[model samples]
Every structure is written in structure tokens, then in C-alpha cells.
Target: MTLLDLTAPPSRSDRLTALPVAIVGAGPVGLAAAAHLVERGIDVVILEAGPDAASSVRAWGHTRLFSPWRHVVDPAAVRLLETTGWTLPDADRAPTGAELVESYLLPLARLEAIASRLRTGIRVTDISREGMDRTRTRGRAAAPFVLRTQTADGAIGEVTARAVIDASGTWHSPNPLTSSGLELLGLTDVADLVTAPLPDVLGRDRARFAGRHTTVVGAGHSAANTLLALVELSRSAPGTRVTWMIRNASAIRLSSSTEDELSDRAKLGGRVEQAVAAGEVDLVDGFEIIRARRDGDRVVVVGSRRGEVVEHPTDLVVNATGFRPDLSMLREIRLDLDEIVEAPRRLAPLIDPNVHTCGTVEPHGFRELTHPEPGFFVVGMKSYGRAPTFLLATGYEQVRSVTAWLSGDLASASTVALTLPATGVCSTDIGGAGCC
Candidate 1:
């Protein structure tokens, strides 16, 4: 009944049978993993940290995804949903985060196979072998994984599984405002003035920016979204101002949207271009922010610009700098992560932002996602580590292959069946700005 008991064998010579796979995070990829594994008759248990599925996605519910329904919805999940007579949304129409949850993830979670196996309001704190630490190797592969979890009521519990897939994304961890990738000095003092990367600016959070001079940081799509929202807010609420800052010498890096295969992504670049041309948003180029402090009612942002110290005083700061994976939880698990990207060593090159564009990155499966640990994988946006070129379609393919391998379908696991659209641009300088 317990995970440790499952590891106990009739004899040392007998092969250990695989137990149910435990998936952390109930976002799109995590739920898709459940769908695929369940279809294969593999027992699955999903642990979600929030009250419902796609909690992180719900946080930025207002923003529309660049990819349409066809790209975001996993095929395995669709098959499961179809059995229940679920109606599919428009394949070509892009849905906002809210629509994604309501129309797809929500309905998929309601399936009898998934709903019964899902445990909401549970956070997975740590994962390791039942009887072995990272230092011990004897019987390690045979021992089931022990996941330490915390419930909403503050109760601690443990669940054991034959395999683990970390689909927990990087949304909760945003990069710091500093150009050095570290926290800005004196950031805590003015932290109250900073907003999340994707705030509901046009909705509930409008009053916060209506008539204030807000400075948006970073060069990614999230930043672009915030800038556009601020521009819209300024039109209705005069006296509202928006200032854009980036470490890049110029905003030309964002010009790639014009050449992107996806029309929605291209339109984002066009909108930003028009905003800049019309002087609707102020551009602060080459601004390497290094420090922050509160100045009376305003926050003073201090940084260096071309060897000279520069300061910008503003009422609010939106830190749209991207996110990084939380690796601390897996410290006791053996992970062969790349030195730079922090992704699996074999997967780093294919997704390296320095060389491959989003589309150019080859289709990968179980081999690329595997770690030194026998039955553990990092998928979804978390698998990309610091690289910013992840797409929902990529994560769907990942779980598909991982589930196949878990179910003993070696042939299906080895076949790379994913194809993605390219950003039409590649650069190492893609620093935290762009769609996931």
C-alpha cells in the first residue's frame, strides 16, 4: 500500500514493477501527462498547488495566447475529452488564458479518469527515493520516489511513485529587475511599488496605473503586453504615462515579430512599433538597472547607461524579466542539468536560445528529457530553464513521449513526432522577453 512497501521485493533477482507515476503541478502539461498515461492504463496521481487546475494560467487569464487552439491543446487530452462528448473550440482562433482553462483544461479535468486521480491544494515540496539519499546508490533505482507534500490545511504528507514528472512551471519565479540577473540592491524597500510580470492592468488593476507614471522593464512579450495595456489605459485616463526600459542598445531585437510565422506574434511587434513611433511610450535604451530605492511617494530606479550612472523616478515598476526554474526542491534527486540553461544536459543544445529559433529546435522526446535519475523528468516551460522559446505544443509532445516510455512503449517514445513554428529570429540576447 505504501511506496516503500512496493519497493520491497519477493527476491533480489526479481525485476521491480513500475508503480503509478506522480505528476506535480496541474497546469496544461501536467494534465496532459495524466491524460496520456491514463489512456495507456498507467495509474497516475496529479498534485496541484492551487485550488483548481491551471492555477498559474488563471493568474494571467486576461492575456490571449499567441498560438491558437490547434497548437495549445494536446492531442491525447483531446481524445479523452471526446469520449465524454466535449465540443472542441475553433482550431484557428487564439484563446486567452481564461478561455484555455474554461474551454479545455477545465473540461479535461472533469473526466472521470483525471478528476479521481487529481488532488488540488497540494504542493510538492521535495522528491527523493524512499530509503536512499542522493549519496546512496544501492537499490536506488528499485526504490520508489517519495514526494513530500504540504496541504492547504498545513498538514504534511508523503506520496510514493515509480516515476515523477515535474511539470511545475516558472511563472511563480520572475527574474529580478537587475541586469546582472541578481536582485537589485534596495529592492525590498520599494518592493511594494513593483507589480507582477502579467498583471490585469486593464481589468482589476487599472486604478493602480490610471494616472501614474509607470516604468515597464524587460523586452519580452509580457513586457509588450504590459506596455500595450498601459497605452490603452492612458487613452481613457489622461496623465497616465508609460516608460519602456531594456538593457539592449535598441528595440530592433523585437523586430523579429514582423518576420514570425504566427500572425498574432507579428502583430505584437507591430503594435509596439506603432506605440514607439507615435511617442505613446518612452524608450530608455541601454539602461542597465542596478539598484532601487523609495523617494518620498516615488521610486527612484538607478542604473548605468553607457558608462554613466542614470536614474529614473517613477511611481510604479513592472518587472517583466522572465522566470527561472526552482531547482532547490530536487536537490536530493540526481539531475544532469546543463551548466548554462539548467535544462537536461542532452536537451540544452536543441533549445539553446543562442543557436536555435523556436521552430528550428528539433523535435525531442524521452531521451532528451531524461536525467541521471531513473524515472524523473522535467517538462514544459520548466524544462527550458532560462531559455525563453518554449511553446505549448512542445510540452504536449514531451508528455506524450514520456507517457509512452512509462507505459513500456519504446517504439512510440523514441519517435519524434512534434513540429513547431519558428520565431524567424535567433539570438543569445533573448533575455526574458517573449512568449513562452
Candidate 2:
């Protein structure tokens, strides 16, 4: 039997008949989707708004993930990495946002799987189905879905596909704390409080904040990280003072109660304890920021805490607030949305049991694809709303289910293959770097 050349490009006319699947946002989810399709011999096209795989991570490059490297690396992606002889990091060690994207995501794209299919620097402006009567030059069947995008070369183009998936992450947009029970503590415009590129408090700029009073608002991982950095900064820059102003009675803790020691809430609680004990930071809880105004060189933060009004003089206000999904692209596609979560209400069922999909060997976050808009799915943190705790493993499962659904093989796809390798009896024998 002769080996087939699977990498040849199809003729231009083949575009009319190619089973095209378009994926938006090239974070872990979109990349996983692309890998899955290629593995199944399906044609896929991935449109990424950024320059590369971890652009979103690069945007928040200054920060590290709450979970370790093990949680962020997609299992199927790991297998693909093994094919290229790359050794993965240990599961216990969490990587920074920059390392996760640069180390894992970019390398996978360079592999034979789905490399040519990726279109970078392509921003998706809108997604919608073309009318059935609309023709490809006046006399053809209307495409099912169209993605309007602007290319890197300043070229505007449209890609029509049988299905579309949105894997854009949390940085789509920022979520103001005011939306989550914090009153305006007198600051009208929150954008001007800090400098751009997001300050790395513990980074080289530690000297700038030293000996100065700083106010941090919000209670998520961002706030926690900010506080931790400030604490470290205070040690060297003894002139810097830190204050964590929260609307809640205390720092917001992680909801997972499964672990007694490793829970995020517990860790954060400890950080708060250390900061308070050191006298470098103050925790002013149960306070609602009422207003803010510039008085010469300092900012006056006024609010009411526990029914008592209070005011504080500050140097800077860092909003470790939160993020929201930028749905501007989906403003055209109509789907059943949850009023509160603002995600697809039907998305829960797809990942509820955590089944696999075809294009990738991971569990997917298909719940975000709740509408009857078959062939479409949403994965990654953006699909989860303001809540965190998404694992890359969950994204892999999502890809498995989605690819299976795409290829019309969902049920059989869930069952992992039991076939034995002819020579490599154990996984380690085949270029064993321990991924087995």
C-alpha cells in the first residue's frame, strides 16, 4: 500500500465543496479545535485577532495563572507536543500567563497539525448567516455562516463556513466593580487612575510606589495578585503603603470546597493575613466607594463602610476589578442567552457529563453554544462569565465533543480507543518523555 500525501493544498474551486469550520479566537480552545479537525482529516480554518497563540496571555503578560501549568496545558495538546519531542512541566507548578502561552500554545501551532490553516492578525468584526437567496456572485446557494474580518495587510475579507466557534478569553473587556455591588466612591472615570500596560506592582516599578499610599479595589485573583505584589514591593520600598478596599466583608474566596488546604480562597485569606500583620496593607471591608476627586497631588477616596461614612487619602487606585465578554462580534447572531450569566443557558449540558469531541481529544465548553445554531460552539474562560476555575482539561473535553459532533460521530467519539500499538507496548516506549 502506498502512503498518501495528506498535506497538499486543494484546488481553488475546492473551496466551494470543502467542509469548512471557522474558529474565532486562537487561545487554547480555538487551537484545540483546529488540532482536532486536522487529526480527523477534516478541513478547518482558525481566525485569530491577535498576532499569535498567546496574544491574550501576552496582553495580561504581567500576571500568572491561579492554577498551575498542569491545569492550563490541554492533554491532547500535550500529546501533540510529544510528537515534537517537547517535555512538559510538572502538574503541581502553575505558570505565568506569558509562559503558558509562549511555551505550550505557540509550539503546537508550528506542528504539522493545523498550522497552515491558522490566520493571524485577523479580527472578527461580526458573525451571521447569509440569507439563503444571497449568491456567491449572484447565482449560488447562500453560505450558512459568514465571518467578517480585517486582515493584517489591511484587507477586508469574509469567510463562510458550515460552523463557527468562539473561544475568545476573559480579556475581551473589563468588568467594572460597580456592576458587582460596589458603589461609585466619587471617581467618575476609572480609566485614568493608573498607567497603561497594567502596572506590575512587584515588578521593576516597585520604587515608583514606594512610600506612597496605594488603594486597590476588587476581590478576585487580580486583586489578590495586586495585593501580593504590593506586599513584596513594600519590603524594599518602605515608603509605599497599601490599602485593599472591598465591598464585601472580606476578600472574595474561591467557591470550590472540595479541598481543605489547596483552595484558592484559603490561599488568598492567608495573603490578606500576612499583609495585615506586616502593617504594610489595610483591609477596609464593607465599604462602598461614593466618590473620588483629585486634590492637588493626592486622590481623596470617600465611601461608607458598614453604615458608617469614611474617607481616605490615596496615591493610586488600582481596579483589580474583573472582566466581561466582548459580545460585539455576536451582536448579529441570535442565541438563547442567560440574563444573569450573559452566556448561553443551554451550554451546561454539553460539558455537564464532560464528554469528548473529535477535532481534539479534550472535553469542551459546549454549553456556551446552547442555541440551535448547530456547528457552532464557544470554549475557554470567556464562556464562563465573571467566574473563574476553568481548566485546560475541560477545554480538551470540549474539543472532543465538538469535533465528534462536527463529523457526525458524537457517541462513538466519547469511547477512548483501546487499540494497542504494534511495537510500543507501553506509552513510554514511543519517544518516551513521560507524557505517557
Q: Where does candidate 1 stray beyond 4 Å?
A: 1-18, 419-436
Across 358-431, the per-residue lDDT of candidate 2 in tens digits comes to: 11222333333445444556666556444333444555566766676666564644443312111110000000
Clashing pairs in 1: 220-433, 220-434, 221-434, 359-422, 390-436
lDDT against the true structure, per candidate, is 0.81, 0.59
CA shift of 275, model 2, Å: 1.4
lDDT of 1 by residue, 1-436 (tens): 0122212112221233546789999998899999999999988899999999988888888877776677778888999999988878998777787898999999999889999999999999999998899989777877888999999899999998888999998877778899898988998899899988877889989999999999999887788888999999999998999999999887543544555666676688789879988999999989999999899878999999999998999999998877888898898999888899998888999988778556667778888888878788999888989877676677788999888887777788888766545522211111221232
> What is candidate 2's CA lDDT for residue 366?
39
Indicate the residue-level lDDT of 204 in model 1: 85
lDDT of model 1 at position 266: 64
lDDT of 1 at 195: 87
